[model samples]
Target chain A: MQITRQEIAGMDKRFRANFINSLSGFKSANLIGTVDMQGISNLCIVSSVFHVGANPPLLGMIMRPHTVARDTLQNIKDTEEFTINHVNSSMVRQAHQTSARYPSDVSEFDAVGLSQYKSTLLNAPYVEESKVRIGMQLRSIQEIVLNKTELVIGEIIEVQMDNKYVLEDGFIELEPMNGVVVSGVDAYHSTQIIDRLSYAKPDASASSIRGHAK
Target chain B: MQITRQEIAGMDKRFRANFINSLSGFKSANLIGTVDMQGISNLCIVSSVFHVGANPPLLGMIMRPHTVARDTLQNIKDTEEFTINHVNSSMVRQAHQTSARYPSDVSEFDAVGLSQYKSTLLNAPYVEESKVRIGMQLRSIQEIVLNKTELVIGEIIEVQMDNKYVLEDGFIELEPMNGVVVSGVDAYHSTQIIDRLSYAKPDASASSIRGHAK
Candidate 1:
């Protein structure tokens, strides 16, 4: 159907605004700093975690647009290091608190009361309470011209996760982690375990369907 | 941890060949071709649908990077036209067949056996089997570097959905439509309907909670 620009803009304003301002549509623990030569620490809670590639195990997170200057963005760019911590239900409130606009000098960990630990290979800190934390080296940052948003891509350097959450093969049990799915904007959600279907492939024959019959 | 280029390539190859290749991703329903003086049709499928903007109702999809000669991509690019059809569970097999590398002169709808209808305002046709079809105008075509991927961004010009799937507010009820989620290189997925949570926002508070609760 024919629609005017005004109609399209009106329909999208609310969803767009919510998407930009909301925390993670899905909650993952994000650690806030890098370790210094003297063991100094910095911290922030970032919610833009995304898997950019599988082969090299790359992960990405978009920092809030650098309105003034952002510490997490700066540290990742300067030191080329950071860590991603998966936020479970227990860390929801604390993670929310980290999204607050604090001064550059402030430590988000101190503000939100979460313990930090050194990353295995990277210079960044990992959230001690997180069920899974991944250390990464910044790969590249692309400025998405359409929206002026920075897409920060990182290469996975090392991974550390609580064994309890990993399956024998590598499937992650996301339910117990209380992974949240973001919707309209700033809401938090707890996911329920639904049926986990067997993997399906494009060329698999009928025999492959047997495993999923269960 | 420091990994050699060999290791990276090995992991990338394995991930692309196995893990990603074994999953079920989306196969989209797309219609192409301009209606002649007499109504003739050309319809097909594209699996690379993606979102480009929240504001202005923008969306994007990647076409065969080498479609330098195919009529589908050419028609969309030449006429600056196309429609997006959301493939429901019922259309899975037919949708899959649309991907066959047919000659430009052949219509997949005839080859795979499906029907097509004209879009309301746009020149492109719409797959009759699709539950949700959106007519869009080409905004830009960007070629991704180092890859045979062409990112076609579009502005959502008009949307048509089964009334049953449209919710009280503007939120589209995606469950009944059996919305397919795409991943990796090639696959088809039927998503399990998780709980529909309230839209979250950064500014959410007890007062806003009460308002939504009502």
Candidate 2:
């Protein structure tokens, strides 16, 4: 089916949101953990996380317009710190529950039955149940003026994970980590390694990297 | 194992790149097709695509710092048009091959053996093998000062896909579409739908939406 801009613009709001959201394909699913000035912790599932750079160790995620109360965005602005915990297969249900619209005073950590882990370097709490957790310090926040959405960029300050998951080449084995991806608003997915090819070269045929395949 | 920022900064460059890149989890893999001023078609595999907004139908993707010549970014800037085609399982190898550094005059479509599908709605060419293809008009380009990376935002102008792949709720069935996701630089993944739950609510347990589970 072909959907032109006219057809897409004419779509029902809810239908359009879902259709447009899933059009980008599967997204990184993570529980963003944050804390307010009052030391209240907040956790929410966000799938828009993407790599911005690797040298300064930066990561970025999009936050919807602040027309409504957004505790995560507010807390990140207040404390300048947060944790991104990858949503794994074991706790996806609890992770998704964190998306519920709760009061500002209510901590999703306690509300969703997920334990929080704290460290001296950051004010935001981490999801103790998450296998791959990253502690980040707010680097900069850019308001995408086109739409009122905010692009929150953070520098990774701390990373906690099982050493066994890290390969000699430094690639973390996600399948063993049990990390999952999300589509639309509610669908969860598990990934199977489809083969990692060697670095592409203009004159060479792509070949599988030895021992990189599961 | 816990890695601190100090340790990350001190790691070998290659190891650090791999580690930091993989830390963000899986990303949406797509072939961004663009046509230069001379009408030459170009395709490159990019994993940074993410949803920005739905109302105006926007999408954003990061282009590495243009310290080197980048044909796709230059084409989008010159022509103000491009197409994002989701990479599928059947063409994963061919798609990955498009990442190889090619000269400005060389089109990955011809070099990588993928056919281009052109439409009148947009000047950019689309990948004929892709199931979900999006035609976009360049909206804005913002450079991240923290890193020299460029964020290219585009408005969805056209969408072409199979009718059966879209559900009544507007979510595209990715598994049925054979859409694939990428982790780190070279790893490709095929996703299996675990389940699609009902909308999260403060006091309710998430229940699977009927017939949405795999």
Candidate 3:
């Protein structure tokens, strides 16, 4: 099948969104946890999480235009702190529920039956059910003018996870954690480690490392 | 284990990079195909591709700071055309080899042994081995000042794929294509579709959609 720029522009609104969203393949499934000044908590599922820089340990996520009330973006701006929790297989249904539009006063954690976990060093609440939770401090925000979207960059301030999942070379073994990946807005997937190859060098064949998988 | 911000800042340089890169979980594995004005082609693996917006069909990728020569970024800036090919399990090793630091005169395609495919509509070369390929034209570029990374946004101009992989609702079934996902710098993963759920709504459970997966 071949789809051109003209055809894509002519597609139905919702159809184009679904088609374009899934074109990039599976995305990291994470729930962004934040809180307002009044201590009101908000949890929204986002799949745009990507690595930005490692020295400062920055992670970036895209936020849609504020055509409606964007509680998660607003909360992060006001507090400058948020938590990114990996959505696992067991909590897929509950995590999907967080996408529904709830009232400003309503807390998704309470509405969806997920617990809020607070760390001593960060102001935002983390999802207690997530096996991998990261506390981040807002580093920068860039507005994408072409589409009114905002790129939110945050520095990883704290990481809380099981020590068993951390490999000797600093890679996190996610298969044992049952970490889920999202396709489009509806599909969820579980992954298996095919292999972890050693660092690539010129004129050298990539070799697999043993005992890296948990 | 709990890693605090101070501790992360104090860790060794290479250790921190690996730890922080894998913290975000799995990422989309893709080989970006680009060509220079002289028609010299280049292929490099990138895990930073994220959907910017569907209305404009824009996709964004992060380019690390050009502390050293960045052939991929330079080629895209000069020509404003590129192709994004989804990496599959069969070509994992060759895809990883593209990440090696090859000099400007050396084409990774030749060095890594992948065929360059060109379509009539787009000037950039695509990977013939890839089951899914997207042709894109540069739309915008924004400089991330804090980290000196560049966010390159491109509009999806053409899409060529096997017709069977696309679902009725526009989501592409990746498992049948043997698409691979990358974790950190070296790990590759194969995914299994747990289920495709219907659109979320308030006061309702997410039910699986039948006949969505191939």
Candidate 4:
């Protein structure tokens, strides 16, 4: 079936939100951990984080700074520091719980039963149970004049994860860390490797990386 | 292990690239299909597309407009339209092959052996094999001066998909489409649904949606 924009606009509010959200395909599931100026910790599930560049190691996320993610936005603006923790398989429910509109003084980490850890570099709290945690410093914030969403770009100042998960060939095996992805806003999933292909060349067919297949 | 940015910069080039890419967790795997002025069709892999907003149904992507992805970027800019097709499990290898540096006159659709079909609303071709295809009209393109990457924003004008995959509650079941996601630049995987939880609320624990769990 083909759905026109007008038809989509006419759909029920929640239905349109769900339908539009799922259209982007699978999304990264990470908990954005921040701390307000008063030292109250804040945690929320943010699926918008995506790689911006590799050399300087920047990550950018779409945040409705004026609305939904105000706590995170305020914290990042107040402290210019935050943490991104992968929502591993065991932490899905607890991570999802972070999306609740907890009061600014209430720490989602405490309310949701996830432990907090502060890395050596950033003041933002990290999820202690998360296998992959990154300390980030605010690099820049650009607002999309279109719909009031802000583009929050940050530099990865530090990364803390188990060394065993980092492969010799440069890839980090996410399966070992139990890193999960989400569909729509609530469908959580873990992945099964379909094989990693080598760099593509016009004259050659992409083959599975050696020793990656059964 | 804790790796500081300084240490990350000192690591081998490819090692740093892979390690940093994996830090964002899983990414959406989709082929941006477009056509040049001469109507030369082009297809390329883009994992940077992320949901920007829900009301206007906008999607944004990070593109190095000056360098890599020049073809897809140029085509989208020239035509003011494009298609985003979910890279399903069966099309991963062929979709990855589209990333090769094919010349301007050569259509990647042919080189990669994926069939293309044009919808009534857009000139850009959609991947016939893609279970979910979206026709997008370029809304705005902003330059990320820091890295010369452009944030290409598009509005969903039309969506083509099997209505059966769209649930009564509006969540589109990706598993039925076999949608695949990427980790790093080349690692691809299909997902196993852990469960779909209900909306988060301050007073309750999240439970799997009825009929969505075993």
Ranking by DockQ: 4, 2, 3, 1
Model 3 residue B90 distance off true place after TM-score fit, in angstroms: 0.8
Q: How high is each candidate's interface RMSD, in Å?
A: 7.0, 0.7, 1.0, 0.7
Docking class of 2: high
CA lDDT of each prediction against the hidden true structure:
0.52, 0.89, 0.87, 0.90
- Candidate 4 ranges with C-alpha deviation above 4 Å: A66-68, A210-214, B210-214
Locate the minimum summed-lDDT window of 10 residues in model 3 chain B: B64-73
The candidate with the higher lDDT, 2 or 4, is 4
Residue-level error in angstroms, candidate 1, position A162: 7.2
Top lDDT hit = 4
Chain A TM-score from candidate 3: 0.96
Docking quality of model 3: it rates as medium
Clashing pairs in 3: none
Each candidate structure's TM-score, on Cα atoms with residue i matched to residue i, is 0.65, 0.97, 0.97, 0.98
Candidate 3 displacement at residue B96 in angstroms: 0.5
lDDT tens digits by residue: candidate 4, A1-214? 9999999889899988888999999999999999998889999899999999888899988888765479999999999998999999998999998888877889998999999998768789999999999999999999898798899999999999998888876688898678899999889999999989998998999898946522
Name the better of 1 and 3 by DockQ: 3
lDDT of 4 by residue, B50-99 (tens): 99988899998988866558999999889999999999999999999998
Candidate 2 on B148-200: residue-level lDDT in tens?
A: 99999999999999888788988889888889999888889999888888888
Ranking by TM-score: 4, 2, 3, 1
Worst 10 residues of 2 chain A by lDDT: A64-73
